[model samples]
Target: MPDYDLNRLGSRAFEQMVVALGRPELGPGVQVFGDGPDGGREATYDGTINWSAAAVGVPGGSEVWVGHTVLQSKFQIKPKPQPQDNAVWLQGEISKEIGHWIKAAKAGRPRGTEA
Candidate 1:
Protein backbone atom coordinates (compact mmCIF):
# COMPACT_ATOMS: atom_id res chain seq x y z
CA MET A 1 0.00 0.00 0.00
CA PRO A 2 1.14 3.52 -0.71
CA ASP A 3 1.11 6.38 1.75
CA TYR A 4 -1.20 8.41 -0.42
CA ASP A 5 -4.67 7.65 -1.70
CA LEU A 6 -4.06 5.06 -4.38
CA ASN A 7 -6.76 6.12 -6.80
CA ARG A 8 -5.78 9.74 -6.71
CA LEU A 9 -2.07 9.13 -6.49
CA GLY A 10 -2.06 6.47 -9.15
CA SER A 11 -4.03 8.54 -11.61
CA ARG A 12 -1.67 11.43 -11.06
CA ALA A 13 1.30 9.15 -11.30
CA PHE A 14 0.16 7.62 -14.55
CA GLU A 15 -0.50 11.04 -15.99
CA GLN A 16 2.92 12.26 -14.99
CA MET A 17 4.51 9.11 -16.38
CA VAL A 18 3.00 9.77 -19.76
CA VAL A 19 4.22 13.32 -19.76
CA ALA A 20 7.68 12.30 -18.65
CA LEU A 21 7.75 9.80 -21.45
CA GLY A 22 7.30 12.72 -23.85
CA ARG A 23 3.83 11.64 -24.84
CA PRO A 24 1.75 14.58 -23.71
CA GLU A 25 -1.25 13.32 -25.66
CA LEU A 26 -1.25 10.11 -23.69
CA GLY A 27 -1.55 11.69 -20.24
CA PRO A 28 -5.28 12.06 -20.55
CA GLY A 29 -5.59 8.37 -21.20
CA VAL A 30 -5.39 7.71 -17.45
CA GLN A 31 -8.82 8.07 -15.91
CA VAL A 32 -9.92 8.23 -12.30
CA PHE A 33 -13.43 7.27 -11.21
CA GLY A 34 -15.39 6.61 -8.03
CA ASP A 35 -15.59 3.06 -6.76
CA GLY A 36 -18.10 3.50 -3.94
CA PRO A 37 -17.75 2.69 -0.23
CA ASP A 38 -15.66 -0.39 -0.63
CA GLY A 39 -12.83 1.83 -1.81
CA GLY A 40 -11.99 5.27 -3.08
CA ARG A 41 -11.86 4.85 -6.84
CA GLU A 42 -10.33 3.15 -9.82
CA ALA A 43 -7.73 4.36 -12.30
CA THR A 44 -8.39 3.24 -15.86
CA TYR A 45 -5.31 3.69 -17.99
CA ASP A 46 -5.46 2.95 -21.67
CA GLY A 47 -3.82 -0.37 -22.39
CA THR A 48 -1.36 0.35 -25.12
CA ILE A 49 1.51 -1.79 -26.29
CA ASN A 50 0.79 -4.19 -23.45
CA TRP A 51 1.11 -1.54 -20.76
CA SER A 52 -1.53 -0.62 -18.20
CA ALA A 53 -1.85 0.56 -14.62
CA ALA A 54 -4.35 0.81 -11.78
CA ALA A 55 -4.66 2.04 -8.23
CA VAL A 56 -6.93 1.17 -5.30
CA GLY A 57 -7.49 3.21 -2.16
CA VAL A 58 -7.43 1.52 1.20
CA PRO A 59 -7.84 2.76 4.76
CA GLY A 60 -4.75 3.32 6.85
CA GLY A 61 -2.70 5.98 8.59
CA SER A 62 0.66 5.31 6.98
CA GLU A 63 -0.62 4.25 3.62
CA VAL A 64 -3.93 4.61 1.84
CA TRP A 65 -3.47 2.93 -1.51
CA VAL A 66 -1.63 0.44 -3.63
CA GLY A 67 -0.67 1.10 -7.24
CA HIS A 68 0.47 -1.35 -9.84
CA THR A 69 1.43 -1.49 -13.49
CA VAL A 70 1.19 -4.62 -15.53
CA LEU A 71 2.12 -5.83 -18.93
CA GLN A 72 -1.11 -6.97 -20.52
CA SER A 73 -1.69 -10.71 -20.76
CA LYS A 74 -1.00 -10.60 -24.45
CA PHE A 75 2.50 -9.34 -23.73
CA GLN A 76 3.23 -11.52 -20.71
CA ILE A 77 3.23 -14.88 -22.44
CA LYS A 78 6.95 -15.26 -21.85
CA PRO A 79 8.76 -15.02 -18.52
CA LYS A 80 9.67 -11.55 -17.40
CA PRO A 81 13.03 -10.54 -18.79
CA GLN A 82 15.84 -9.56 -16.41
CA PRO A 83 15.58 -5.91 -17.32
CA GLN A 84 11.89 -6.02 -16.71
CA ASP A 85 12.34 -7.64 -13.34
CA ASN A 86 14.71 -5.03 -11.97
CA ALA A 87 13.01 -3.35 -9.03
CA VAL A 88 15.24 -0.30 -9.34
CA TRP A 89 14.28 0.22 -12.96
CA LEU A 90 10.58 0.03 -12.27
CA GLN A 91 10.90 2.15 -9.14
CA GLY A 92 12.96 4.72 -10.93
CA GLU A 93 10.48 5.03 -13.75
CA ILE A 94 7.52 5.28 -11.40
CA SER A 95 9.31 7.66 -9.11
CA LYS A 96 10.39 9.88 -11.93
CA GLU A 97 6.74 10.20 -12.82
CA ILE A 98 5.01 10.43 -9.42
CA GLY A 99 7.72 11.66 -7.09
CA HIS A 100 7.30 15.31 -7.92
CA TRP A 101 3.58 15.15 -7.36
CA ILE A 102 4.07 13.48 -4.02
CA LYS A 103 6.64 16.04 -3.00
CA ALA A 104 4.41 18.94 -3.95
CA ALA A 105 1.49 17.45 -2.10
CA LYS A 106 3.52 17.01 1.03
CA ALA A 107 4.95 20.51 0.89
CA GLY A 108 1.53 22.07 0.37
CA ARG A 109 2.78 23.37 -2.91
CA PRO A 110 1.10 23.54 -6.29
CA ARG A 111 2.22 21.96 -9.51
CA GLY A 112 4.52 23.86 -11.86
CA THR A 113 6.57 25.51 -9.20
CA GLU A 114 9.12 28.10 -10.22
CA ALA A 115 11.49 27.24 -7.40
Candidate 2:
Protein backbone atom coordinates (compact mmCIF):
# COMPACT_ATOMS: atom_id res chain seq x y z
CA MET A 1 0.00 0.00 0.00
CA PRO A 2 1.11 3.56 -0.62
CA ASP A 3 1.54 6.09 2.15
CA TYR A 4 -1.23 8.67 2.08
CA ASP A 5 -0.24 12.32 2.25
CA LEU A 6 -2.81 13.19 4.88
CA ASN A 7 -1.40 16.68 5.24
CA ARG A 8 -3.01 17.52 1.92
CA LEU A 9 -6.43 17.16 3.54
CA GLY A 10 -8.11 19.47 6.02
CA SER A 11 -9.18 18.19 9.43
CA ARG A 12 -12.76 17.39 8.46
CA ALA A 13 -11.59 15.78 5.26
CA PHE A 14 -9.14 13.69 7.21
CA GLU A 15 -11.92 12.63 9.51
CA GLN A 16 -14.04 11.67 6.54
CA MET A 17 -11.21 9.56 5.19
CA VAL A 18 -10.84 7.85 8.51
CA VAL A 19 -14.54 7.10 8.64
CA ALA A 20 -14.57 5.76 5.11
CA LEU A 21 -11.67 3.47 5.86
CA GLY A 22 -13.22 2.24 9.09
CA ARG A 23 -16.89 1.91 8.12
CA PRO A 24 -16.33 -1.33 6.32
CA GLU A 25 -14.76 -2.94 9.36
CA LEU A 26 -16.87 -1.12 11.91
CA GLY A 27 -20.20 -1.78 10.19
CA PRO A 28 -22.90 0.54 8.87
CA GLY A 29 -24.09 1.54 12.34
CA VAL A 30 -21.20 3.95 12.85
CA GLN A 31 -22.42 7.49 13.49
CA VAL A 32 -20.47 10.34 11.92
CA PHE A 33 -20.40 13.79 13.51
CA GLY A 34 -19.69 17.16 12.01
CA ASP A 35 -17.73 20.33 12.78
CA GLY A 36 -17.57 22.22 16.11
CA PRO A 37 -17.16 20.46 19.42
CA ASP A 38 -17.57 16.74 18.87
CA GLY A 39 -17.21 15.88 22.52
CA GLY A 40 -13.93 14.29 21.44
CA ARG A 41 -15.69 11.97 19.04
CA GLU A 42 -15.36 12.25 15.28
CA ALA A 43 -17.16 8.94 14.83
CA THR A 44 -19.00 6.57 17.14
CA TYR A 45 -19.71 2.85 16.97
CA ASP A 46 -21.90 0.89 19.38
CA GLY A 47 -21.95 -2.62 17.99
CA THR A 48 -19.50 -5.39 17.42
CA ILE A 49 -16.58 -4.37 15.20
CA ASN A 50 -15.08 -6.91 12.91
CA TRP A 51 -12.58 -7.10 10.10
CA SER A 52 -14.63 -6.95 6.90
CA ALA A 53 -14.92 -10.35 5.32
CA ALA A 54 -13.03 -9.04 2.32
CA ALA A 55 -10.43 -7.57 4.61
CA VAL A 56 -9.47 -10.93 6.03
CA GLY A 57 -10.16 -12.95 2.92
CA VAL A 58 -12.72 -14.91 4.89
CA PRO A 59 -16.47 -15.47 4.47
CA GLY A 60 -17.19 -13.83 7.82
CA GLY A 61 -14.94 -11.28 9.44
CA SER A 62 -13.49 -11.79 12.91
CA GLU A 63 -14.55 -9.73 15.89
CA VAL A 64 -12.29 -6.82 16.89
CA TRP A 65 -14.25 -4.54 19.20
CA VAL A 66 -17.58 -4.47 21.05
CA GLY A 67 -19.69 -1.86 22.82
CA HIS A 68 -19.05 1.86 22.53
CA THR A 69 -16.08 2.94 20.45
CA VAL A 70 -15.05 6.53 19.76
CA LEU A 71 -12.86 7.74 16.92
CA GLN A 72 -10.74 10.88 16.85
CA SER A 73 -8.68 12.11 13.90
CA LYS A 74 -5.77 14.54 14.06
CA PHE A 75 -4.11 15.98 10.98
CA GLN A 76 -0.58 17.36 11.03
CA ILE A 77 -0.13 20.05 8.41
CA LYS A 78 3.62 20.53 8.65
CA PRO A 79 5.31 19.24 5.54
CA LYS A 80 7.19 15.94 5.88
CA PRO A 81 5.78 15.52 9.35
CA GLN A 82 7.51 13.33 11.88
CA PRO A 83 5.83 11.65 14.81
CA GLN A 84 8.54 12.80 17.20
CA ASP A 85 7.78 16.42 16.35
CA ASN A 86 4.20 15.96 17.53
CA ALA A 87 4.71 13.44 20.31
CA VAL A 88 4.26 15.88 23.16
CA TRP A 89 1.31 17.64 21.58
CA LEU A 90 -0.30 14.37 20.70
CA GLN A 91 0.11 13.08 24.25
CA GLY A 92 -1.42 16.21 25.69
CA GLU A 93 -4.30 16.10 23.24
CA ILE A 94 -4.96 12.48 24.08
CA SER A 95 -4.90 13.32 27.79
CA LYS A 96 -7.34 16.13 27.23
CA GLU A 97 -9.74 13.85 25.40
CA ILE A 98 -9.45 11.24 28.13
CA GLY A 99 -10.06 13.86 30.78
CA HIS A 100 -13.11 15.08 28.95
CA TRP A 101 -14.48 11.56 28.74
CA ILE A 102 -13.81 10.93 32.43
CA LYS A 103 -15.54 14.13 33.44
CA ALA A 104 -18.48 13.29 31.22
CA ALA A 105 -18.72 9.85 32.74
CA LYS A 106 -18.77 11.30 36.24
CA ALA A 107 -21.43 13.79 35.23
CA GLY A 108 -23.57 10.89 33.87
CA ARG A 109 -23.65 12.32 30.36
CA PRO A 110 -23.88 9.81 27.57
CA ARG A 111 -20.66 8.57 25.98
CA GLY A 112 -20.98 10.40 22.66
CA THR A 113 -22.38 13.73 23.86
CA GLU A 114 -20.68 16.94 24.85
CA ALA A 115 -20.87 18.25 28.42
Best model per lDDT: 2
Clashing pairs in 1: none
Candidate 1: worst-modelled 10 consecutive residues by lDDT: 69-78
Q: What are the RMSD figures for all models against the true structure?
A: 15.8, 4.0
Worst 10 residues of 2 by lDDT: 54-63
Candidate 2 ranges with C-alpha deviation above 4 Å = 1-3, 51-64, 79-82, 111-115
Q: After superposition, how far is residue 63 of candidate 1 from its true place, in Å?
A: 24
Off by over 4 Å in 1: 1-81, 85-87
Q: Which candidate is the best by TM-score?
A: 2
